[model samples]
Target chain A: MTSEKKIRVLAAKPGLDGHDRGVKVICRALRDAGMEVIYTGLRQTPQQIVKTAVEEDVDVIALSILSGAHNELLPKVAGLLKEQQAEQISLLAGGIIPDSDIPYLKKKGIKEVFGPGTSMNTVIDYIKNYCAR
Target chain B: MDCLCRKISEEKERWVKTTLNKAKCDRRTDENGEDIKVLYTPDDICAIDYLSAIGFPGEYPYTRGVHASMYRGQPWTIRQYSGFATPEETNQRYKYLLKQGQTGLSVAFDLPTQIGYDSDDPMSEGEVGKVGVSVDSLEDMEIIFRDIPLDRMSTSMTINAPAAVLLAMYIAIAKKQGIPSTKLRGTIQNDILKEYTVRGTYIFPPRPSIRLITDIFAFCKDHVPQWNTINVAGYHMREAGCTAVQEIAFSFSNAIAYIEAGIKAGLAVDSFAPRISWIFNTGSRIFEEVAKYRAARRVWAELLKNRFGAKDQRSWMLRYHTQTSGVSLAAQQPENNIVRVAYQALAAVLSGPQSLAACSYDEALALPTEKSVRMSLRTQQIIAHETGVTDTVDPLAGSYYVEYLTNEMAVKINKEIAKIDEMGGAVDAIEKGYIQKEIEERAYIIQKEIDEKKRIVVGVNEYLVDEKVDQALFRVDKKVARQQAAKLKKLKKNRDGQKVQLALEAIRRAAEGNDNMMPLLIEAVNAYATLGEICNTMKCVFGEYRASGWSGR
Candidate 1:
């Protein structure tokens, strides 16, 4: 079960969306997949999300937003990470995000945007591959 | 064990063997994955006493239903949960819904309002009017209900945390509409317990939150007798992935805490219990969903009667609203959700809900569009008019399978409630993350089942297709944020700042003292104080609640 290191991931719900089923599911899946996952509970600002990701020294930041606030919140988190010199941590998110917004979110520095019907295994595998190098 | 029971079991054995020996990989299970016998006979419900358990409708322990005539007298209210973007757009949507034969109105406030922030706050950037309608001040509330008369419409606002402020705004608007507070009819979804457990739109601590709920109860009982002060909701939690049994058990547990808070606040049970409403999510699992409603009503009736010693018949009737599950909607084909929502709405009707809200097909992808919302409302109409489901009272009552499932669900849910009772109460269980962990575990199991192709999600796991879905989705313009911000600024500039300050200070003093804050909140809204200002003033007194996870990182 041992590897070079376990993938430390920070999962958080930013802004005022209270629907955390997706985020909690991802947090548990990543934790069960042998990643050190820290779930920052709901109503988090972008600053708090990135602060925990950096402080916990996580490799990935999984931002879950069902409130459709990702476009506004995602870039804020990414910008904060860049300003705080924590830009190396990959930003990925999944929720009720539309396919039309995926490209824009990706261009905004999100590594991936998982929408509805996404598999947890796919998410875990993506993180594993992204961190393997 | 008994000879008669053994004979009935032998008969069922013969029936299963002769009629139903087919494929066997979990084949005998319901949609919820619960094992079901091919036949349920008298022996299945041997322990039940019909006189006490399944009494007549409108009777004590109302497992059959809260009303005697049920849908025969009048069909369940076809209330659509509609709201998105600016208040003006939402008002238009409401008018359209009412014109399309919607009987009741349900308002869905956006994230900023739900969590008690004005649309202009820096914390509200990019989020205003995204999830629900952005309601910033009394002016927004006025516009939301503008040509719509307050006296006739029984509105339901799904806004918690800052429920007092919103309720205040509603009361003030009714006043402006020349309607007395006593004549105003509606509901404020002030159930904050589920927010701490599942939905995360909570502000202030649980203690103060409960206090505000009690304050609403006390105020509404004498002032706005028609208003439902708090709706004990399991709708969000079930959408968050709790099992049917947990939905009933946990929401009732939260109900117990609220009832206790009301009594502690010196309000009588009969005074508020009649107006108390329960909201359940109608899932795709037909039998389980029906049984969940039956079981939920039974549990609530018994909880009110036995635990709280409520004497009035109205206190024992568990009136509830049902909403089709949003989590059950598929994002793939998207059209499949119409069928799913129809079936769920059918279950809600069969379960005898006081009201039902059908989720539009495109809800999973975005806010429901005009066509989709109309389609959903027509879906309810079809059930009411074309389908004969509303012709009788609890049509599925006599079915052996339904009765057996209902009893089993009641027992399982009772066990969970007992466990929560042992662990102090719902509030304590939530603070301990007990319910959250249970829901998360169930959510994980369902997600894993979908991923493994065990549980079939038609358009997702099965019926695979690569065809692009070009269905129109309702999208909120980014300018909605700017517009709401600008409106809030103009309102602040136009209003008497000194009066707003005095009203907010009154709210703060009431929050600091043990006074019920509803009167002060109503005064604040009358003074044109924004939701954020009122909530921030209370926050200055009670402080905001910050939840750190069990990981302790």
Candidate 2:
């Protein structure tokens, strides 16, 4: 375990979905788990999220979309990250993601998909495992 | 081999005898983070004064319910929150719901409309009709309830930042229908404090926003006496990751701020306090949720009577509407959400909610379709009709566990309220990001528990399903934005531009002065001033609120 280095995360709500329960929950959970989380308030575009991720130099970017606009929004964010030369940072998606969309998202460079009911531990564990590797 | 045998024998002995006496028992904690005993006795509630804590229903300090025979005399209104795409579509849905036994109408505006943007505004691109119905101008509002009688039916609008404009449109519609504004009975979710802390749909900053809230209170007190001016909401706050105690505390603090604002505006406590309502979320925590509602009533009663010096019994009574928590639904094994919603609805019924809205099972995945929405309505109907749970007033009132939980919740919430009061008030707490940070921390702990398997959420971390279920979900039309934009452009071209401009100028003048804004807003809507134009005019006076500290630490 890194003794003093803070676990940094970028928590963003993508797409036009304004419902923020899941995103807020994840943000709280990550913070409680001793991670320094940066939450881009609502209605953040993919470009904005990517820019913030790069500037903040976050170790993880957790994107949440509930309006079923993930298929359109996530790819843009992933592409922006690559274009900005920030592809080394891990990308995670959450909030009502469908099983069918998981493999496709993984292919687009998203590391994992967290659907509804994903516990805070699962997220922390995922981050720890990925970061450790 | 001898050592291994001895270790095995010792372990067996420890498991069989020693561990049985020292095994940890499961202790339930309420949403407020208070520990609940495994068994509660009458001793737990010995301190509660029967006369003060729970007087007769419909009397002073209405702890049982606001009404004597709550569901027995009249059933709680099955108010469903529904809206979509265009004005015409939402109108049809309203008519359909009314036909399907929904007593009252609750309107949900899209994000753009909620934040005071027109359908054609650049900021509103790709979001015209994604979440809820888009109402750009008075024309759209007129189309929304074309045939529905404003006087006969109560309409509750879930709006915040642009609530003043929307309320004006409704009053204008009432005038066009030959119904005086005083005859209208409905509610506007003009609770903007929650918007800043949790919902994030705010327009102006805190000071000007409270001014707008006071403006509505003053207007409704004189003209629309029957209308509920503000619904101090804990629903969105709970959905945004606050615990149950925080929900009650923050919501009551907000209500107190509104009461103080009205008093500051030179209104009597009794004049507007009766019309101020509340909205809360009924979550998956069954007993805890019921206790929350009960505690909420007691707290509101004490605050209004003792703190605000409200003498009117009606002013002291707490009337609330509850919506099942949409966050509790699961996308995996979606059918389980039906059970979850049923329990939540049952809790709301037992908690003596004046009205209730049960979220659809498929809400976690997408906007509910017709069938899913029907199922949600049926869930509430079953509790009201089939289950016989609503036969008595506060059925779970005397249960030892419930009473204990209620008292515990009351104490915890009072403490939280005191904390916020020390930080100046709700507005100050919001500006300093105190409440937001607390909610964030609690939400994270809950999530972490789930992740660690310390909390079991069925069909998610456990009872894994390999197959997917086929369900029909609501899908917005792809061309909705383009079509809405075209309609808005046509509306601007066809309407009387001179009248719209004058109406906007009048609004700006009223906003600049210390004048009540409702009448000016009504005039603007009457002159066909689009929502965006009126909002832009206000924005010029009261600058837009930019959320500070977006980067979480």
Candidate 3:
């Protein structure tokens, strides 16, 4: 069931959060795992992230936010993707997110939430499994 | 001495040849990838003269420590970096911390404030008071320090890019409190070079950013003599995942650029060099971190005295503040981070810094609760009062491994600094994305090592834990954003609009021309103009900076 096409993903940092260490690391790891990663750089608003994802036609949007703005921002991005009819793209998140906030993020359409100490392998595998399914 | 050295070298060679196994000889790299030998004796640091190279504390080439008495004179200040939510809440927290025996104040402005955006700005959505206090005008600053006396408290604000505006607000508040500028003692993290590389709060481009920094240097020299105009920080760089040696080299290179910029701005080297402080990150690799600090002091002294020709004794000293690394903390076994923080803080103390902040154990997850922050401050207090390690100055000065590592670290750090110098300096290197690429490569490797289990992180990679722990994490109230916006609205309604317009115009004129900006900034803040107004006035002239993204190439 291995697909011939490489997975296209967009890594976005939303809401004025500039802790890019996690996002950049995930981007590099995604690229290394044979997926195309387009980093939106630091400080992209939710609208900008959705617009870029829809325009670039990415298969997935991975949002990273270390600043505690995820509660408001993650849902906004999900809502925007739904409004744009781009719900096919899987959404993921990682950063200094507390465990208590994970359920809310998942309910808001984030497929999975990765906290600190998550291995790159786990992320790559999740993407592969999701694509295969 | 030469004959004795030869005899010892021969004896060491003979011992290695007879006793060492192949496995021991095959491994030559230390944790940070530096080459290391099996043993170290007098032969390793034989070339470093004791007096000229590794001199006494408070002397030239201060390899041991900066002050003669060190902690014996006075313990390093317990300066925990804290601020969250509205100005009133942060003010309450400040009072609580001071009552809990915190000595100095280190303010952390929210991201919008750091980037010069008002709470109501579209760019500030969902971000006001998220990470730190949101200050839109002098009114917010007044609330942040409502009852705290400016003259008695030594404050350090972690603000860059818009550091000038924040300092002006601080001075304006002090004036309202009837305190003169001379009585103000504090530091502003005005180091913008790293912003282009790692921190990412930069506003203006490199040339104009350096211009603003130099303006502060000159302004502080004449007006606020006691204020530390800039804290040349490598802490953020290290947190973004550079090695200890790279941290020292890169930060020192940035310092060199600032010194050069100040001299070019028609100021004497010694006049502004003494007020340039530093911020560094200390990690859990105890010996290496300690050696890194020692080598950093020696190399900085040599650079200031010999290269920059700074004549003042104060100019030769490398006074720094150290913070325990937050990246080293793991969320799985949150309690383990306490031990990690303790070890890292011990390393910073052993190396002799002017101030220290131990990261709370719960910071790996979210904002630390009051209980965790109290534990963090208690960690520093324990090291200062309980641990006997601070009984003397530079206790591990003459150890063979520590000295060898310190000397070797200096050589490696100098080599890296030379590479950056050849690229024309920190600004040029950052412009070319050279520094960013180097840091990414190191950071990637570090993460890869942890992933592949080459490096073992307790309770993360090695030990398996299957437990759900419910802990109360401090969450900034979402109401903070609305409240801050309302405050800004009320202030805009009450303030003298014409006077604000006039002050902002003056700022714009000064920013466009070759003029010192501090006096004009103070005037603008006193007129009750918002931070966004002042920064936007300059932004029209300086323009915003968009970094050429590093795609990990």
Best by TM-score: 3
Report the Cα lDDT for candidate 2. Answer: 0.85
Once fitted onto the true fold, the runs of candidate 1 whose alpha carbons sit more than 4 angstroms away are A1-3, B1-10, B13-27, B30-34, B550-553
Candidate 2 CAPRI category: acceptable
Q: Retained native contacts per candidate, as fractions?
A: 0.74, 0.47, 0.57
- Residues A2-49 of candidate 3 have per-residue lDDT tens digits of 457778898989988878888888899999888888888888889989
Predicted candidate 3 versus true structure: per-residue lDDT over B1-553, tens digit per residue? 5777888888888887777753445666775786777788997778778998798998889898989889889889899999999999999999999999999999989999999999999999888998899999999999999999999998999999999999999989999999988899999999999998899898988888899999999988887899999999999999998989999999999999999999999999999999999999999988889999999999999999989999998899999999999999999889999999999999999999999999999998888899999999999999888989999999888888999999989999999999999999988999888988888888899899999998899999999789885778899988999998888889999999999999999999998899998899999999999999999999999999986443332
Q: Give the 10-residue window scoring lowest on summed lDDT in candidate 3 chain B.
A: B544-553
Predicted candidate 1 versus true structure: per-residue lDDT over B10-79, tens digit per residue: 8888877776675353447763576777567977876677888788887777888988898878778999
lDDT by residue (A8-111, candidate 1, tens digit) is: 88888888787888988888888888888888877789988888888889999999888888888898898899999987899998898888888888888899
Extract clashing residue pairs from model 2.
A28-B444, A29-B444, A119-B451, A120-B447, A121-B451, A122-B451
DockQ of 2: 0.37
The per-model DockQ list reads: 0.67, 0.37, 0.62
**Superposed Cα deviation of residue B144, candidate 1 (Å):** 1.0
Q: Please, what are the lDDT tens digits per residue for candidate 2 over residues B481-546?
A: 777888888988998999989989998998899999999999899988889999999999999887
Best by DockQ: 1
Return the TM-score for candidate 3, rounded to 2 decimals: 0.98
